[model samples]
Every structure is written in structure tokens, then in C-alpha cells.
Target: METKKNPNLEIGRNSSIYFAIGLNIMLFFTWRGLEYKSYEKDDFAMEILDIGEEIEEDIPITNLEAPPPPPPPPAAAAPDVITIVEDTEEIEETVIESSETDQDDEIADPIEVSDVAVEEVEEEVSVPFSVVENVPIFPGCKGKNNTELRNCFALKMNEHIKKHFKYPESALEMGVHGKVFVLFAVDANGNVSNIKTRGPDKKLEEEAYRIISLLPTMEPGKQRGRPVKVPYSIPIHFKIQN
Candidate 1:
């Protein structure tokens, strides 16, 4: 028996080839549809810039005034003129002798030195009471020797101070009290002078000086048989009894 269809001409033989071509065509169309681009359209208007026209601004002006000039200075005075005068009197010229001498000249004879009188000049001397030959004599103080006179003078001084000592009221109120050392000198004329005092306060010094100033004039102390100043110092106590 023989087959009715030929093998090469069968319909189903190219079905796969046709299906592949159709599948490829569908895939290409699907890919093109997925990759499709769409955008909204916008309209832009055109405008032109004109820089050819120019703008101008106005500025204000200021005027300044100048200062006045200073006045001229005063004129100076003219200097005095001096005139020259010629001398009219004739002057006599004195002849001067030269002192140079030759061997023929004899030297003047030696000046005679016969007798020269010397004058005794007494100087101002100061002597201490202890070393003086004669101590200053206090009032009613008379002694044959220096020792007795010293004792009597010291006794008299103490008595005088006790008799005249008076404390200053100001010093008492101010409570200024101390021992004031009073220094005084019996001059060559036997007068008390140069009284000085040192103490804790001025009130005490004034009182001490006043007390010493009341001392009576005494006989001046003598050194080498001549009167000399004798310096004496005494302590004046300014104490409050209370």
C-alpha cells in the first residue's frame, strides 16, 4: 500500500517556523509599545532688551568764603649816634729809673732793729668750773678755799631753785613733765647769758629757762688770774605730785 501524503509537503512541518516568526513580531511590537516616549508641549513668547537709551543725574555745587588778613606790626625806634672828640690837654711823661745795679752800687745799711714794743692781746677764753682758779661767787658766798666756795655755791643754787620753782599750768593740764637740763654761762662781766634747755616739752623748757634767768649776777670765774666765761648746767625736774 502507498501513503496518500508526501513527507516533505506536510502542513504541520513548517508550523513551528511560522509560530516563531509571529512570536518575534508580537514581542517587537510589545517592546516598542513599552518604550514609547510622550511629552506635554509648552509655548514660549520672545522679548527684546534695549540698552541704547542713557539716564543722566544732576549734582549740587557749594561755595566757600576766604578769611581776612592780619594787621602789620609796629615800627622799631632808631639807635643813638656817638661823636668822637680830640684831646686838648698835654700830659707830662714821668721818667722811670731802672732798679738794676752794678758792683759800684753799695747796698743800703742793715735796717736798725733797736726795740719792738709788743702789745698784750687778751683773747676770749672759756673755763670749766672745776678747773678754774677762782669759781664764780654766788650771792653771800665767801670761802677761803675753792672747795668751800664750791659747796656754798651748790647750796645757794639749790636754795634759789627751790625758792623760785613753779610748774606751768599748761604743762600740768597737758601732762607734760620730765627732767629739763638747763645750760647757762656766766660771762666775763658776771652776767648770766646763753641759756639753753632740753626737755620732753616746750612748756617745761620755757619754765626752766625762766627760772634760770632769774639768777643774780655773780663774780666771774678766773683762769690764770683773768676772768673767763663759766658754763654751768643744772637739772630741773618737772614731775606731778599726784
Candidate 2:
């Protein structure tokens, strides 16, 4: 005993299996078509690669040439100079003989004959004494007209003092500062002459002389409008204070 099969059930099962197979085939073909389209769009880039490969094959290689060498430096010039040798000659000096001339004979001949006359000459003069009284001393005038004379005299004296002496700092420390009196003559030509120190010290006397020497000649002193030779006197004082 064999039983009969179910035809309707078997047919239904076959229809479901066929539907699943059709869906899988549709999905596989859709993926393959998208991939092929993408490759087709980028085909130009592949042609560029082919062109680069052909260019590389056609290019030829070559050796490069080097640059030219630099020029040489200029030579230095020699210096200009000269050398010389000096030649010297010797000279001899000669001495001459001495003899008496006419001038010497005149001086010596007279003296040799005057021996007796020389014996009679005296050593000193003997003369009678004459008394002098009331000698007139011409003192300078004291007035505005005498100002130039006074200034000139002072200037000379100042110069002389400056030359011969320095300010006495040591003496000043010892309280030994005082005045020295001096007398000098003014001649007709307004020149100072015959200086004298009336009251003296070794230092003071020398200083007085120096000052008098420096003094300029004054306009001669005048008495009643007549110019007269006069004597001028000045006192110089040196003093220091603490």
C-alpha cells in the first residue's frame, strides 16, 4: 500500500522558492551596473597615465657643461726709488805770523819816551774846601697837571718791582711789612736818572733802586711857568693782614 501525494502543497512551495531566487538575482545585477558606470566616468584619468608613460620613454638623457673659469688677478707695480753715495774731501788750516802795525807803533812809541813825564804826575788832587749852603732842591709840582707824570712814574716803578721781587709772603707772616723811602732825579728830557735810597735795608735798598729805574721820565717840574729839573721821591709800603 502506497498513498496518493498532495499536489496543491507541492506547487505552493515551488512558487515561494522561485520568488526568492528572482529577488537575489535583481540585487546582484544592480550592484554590478553601478560599479561599471563609475569606472567608465574615470577613463580619461587612465588615458593621462598612458600619455605620461609614453613621454618618459621618448625623452633622451644628456651630460651638462660646466661654467667658464674666473680671470687671473693683475700684477703689482714696483716702487720708484734711488740710492746715492757721498764723497768727502779733506782741507788743511794754516797759521800766519804776527807783526806790529802802524797803530800799535803810535801807541807804544810815545809811552816809551815819556817815562820822566809820568814820574811827575800826582796820585790825588789837592784843592781848598768851599762851603755850600742852602742848596736848592727842585721838588715836583702837586696838581692835576702832574697826573700824567705821576702815573708814568708809578707804572715804571711797578714794572721794576715786578721784575726784581715777588710779594713777600714769608715777611708778611712775620708781621714785617713796611714802607721804603726813595729819591730819584727827573732830567730835562723827562728821563729818570741818579736813583738814591735814603732810608735802607738790603732788600729795601735794592727794591727802591729797581722801582726808580722803572719810572719813566716826567714832564719837567714847572715853577711860575718855567720848566725845571726836579727830584721825585716815593715811599713803597708792603703790608699783609690775617
Candidate 3:
């Protein structure tokens, strides 16, 4: 069916162009209303004054003289001369007797001196067992040579330890078993000193120390014909037999 078209619906097609033109016209009127204005100019009046010239005065001059120098001191007087007098007298000559002694009239006697013994002072020096020239001699290692004496000393020491070996009762009960290192020194006087021990347990260490301390006195070690303290170290084993 055919229907009549309204003109108001056709004007909507150009409505966007009409809105843009109206917005541009409104922005131009707003910019003109907010235009910047410059401040008004002010007039300044200047006044001139005349300055007078300054006058200078003249200075007076006067002459000055220095005083004369002081006079020098007076010279000292010379000393007077002394006169000497001489007397003529004769002197007599004297005869002197000879004081020489004859060898036949001289007497001589012999002087006798008693004997004096000097005590030797021994210096305490620590010498290692391996490097000592003369090793300490054990109780039963007498009459042995240097090398033989060293071996005998070691053997006797082991024997002594084995003979005196007794496990600590407390250590055995606690099952503490290990090797203990014992260090001792033979002094210049053939006496054992400085006994020390280290082990896993204090009981074992005490036992080792007891055994080492029981060692008999040995002949002191020597170096360069002089006796010296000998330091020796040994390890003792404490093991449980299965």
C-alpha cells in the first residue's frame, strides 16, 4: 500500500551538520568575550639640580736634624816592667856511690800451690731423641755402643711398659679403648721429667702416665761432649680382645 512521507523525518538526515555549525559559532563568540587587555601607560616627571665644586687646601713643610753620635771610651794603661838581680857564687861537685847487687849474694825460695777442684755447670737444653749424638742408656743397657744403646733403650722401654701395663678399671668398665701418646723428657741429671699423655679417655691417659712415670733413671743423653735433656715420645695401644 502507498503511504505519504513526513518532511520532519527528512530534516533529521542533515541534523549533525547543523549542530557542528552552531558549536563553531558559539566558540567564536566565547573567545571574543574572553579577549586579553593591556595596562594603561603612566607619565613620570624628572627634576634637575646643580652640584658645587670642592676646593683643596695646601700643606706646610718643615726640616728636621738628627743628634750627633756619642764619644768613644778611653784606652787602658800599660803594665810596669819588673827588674831581675843575679848573684855570682861557686857550687861544689858531689860523688855518688854505685847501687849494683852481685848475683852470688841473692837468695831464692820455691812457692807451692794447693790443688783446687772446679764444679761443672750443666746447661739444660732439650735435644730430640732421633738427633741426639748419644742416646740415654736404660738400666740394663750399659756397655752398648751408640746405635746398639739406642735400640736397647727402645726395647727396654717397651718391655717396661708391657710389664707395667694395667688397664684402668673404670676405663675397662666403660669400654674406652684407644691409643695414648706419651711424651717424657730425661733431664741432664738422668731424671725423668715433663711427663704428658693424651688419649680418648682421661682414665686411659692417667694409666699411661703412671706407666711412664715408673721408668727408672737413665744415663743422660749427650751432644758435643755435653749432657742434654732428651725428649722422647711413645704411643701405647689399649684394645679389647674379641
Any runs in candidate 3 off by more than 4 Å, and if so which?
A: 1-122, 142-144
Tens digit per residue, CA lDDT, model 3, 1-242: 87889877797899899999999999999998789566555544555776778767777786778888888888887768767767678788798867777877676765545455668975678999999999989998865478888889989999999999998888888899999999999999899999999999999999999999999988899999888999999999999876
Candidate that would win on lDDT = 1
Error of 3 at 206 (Å): 0.3
Clash pairs detected, candidate 1: none
Q: What is each predicted model's overall lDDT from 0 to 1?
A: 0.90, 0.56, 0.89
Model 1 RMSD in Å is: 21.1
Evaluated at residue 76, the lDDT of candidate 3 is 86
Q: Whole-model lDDT for model 2 versus the true structure? A: 0.56
- Candidate 1 yields a Cα-based lDDT of 0.90
Query: Which structure among the candidates has the greatest TM-score?
Result: 1
Task: Tell me how far candidate 2 lies from the true structure as C-alpha RMSD in angstroms.
Answer: 30.2
> Which pairs of residues have clashing backbones in candidate 3?
none
- lDDT by residue (135-183, candidate 1, tens digit) is 9999899899999998899999999999999999998998888999999
Off by over 4 Å in 2: 1-165, 168-176, 224-226
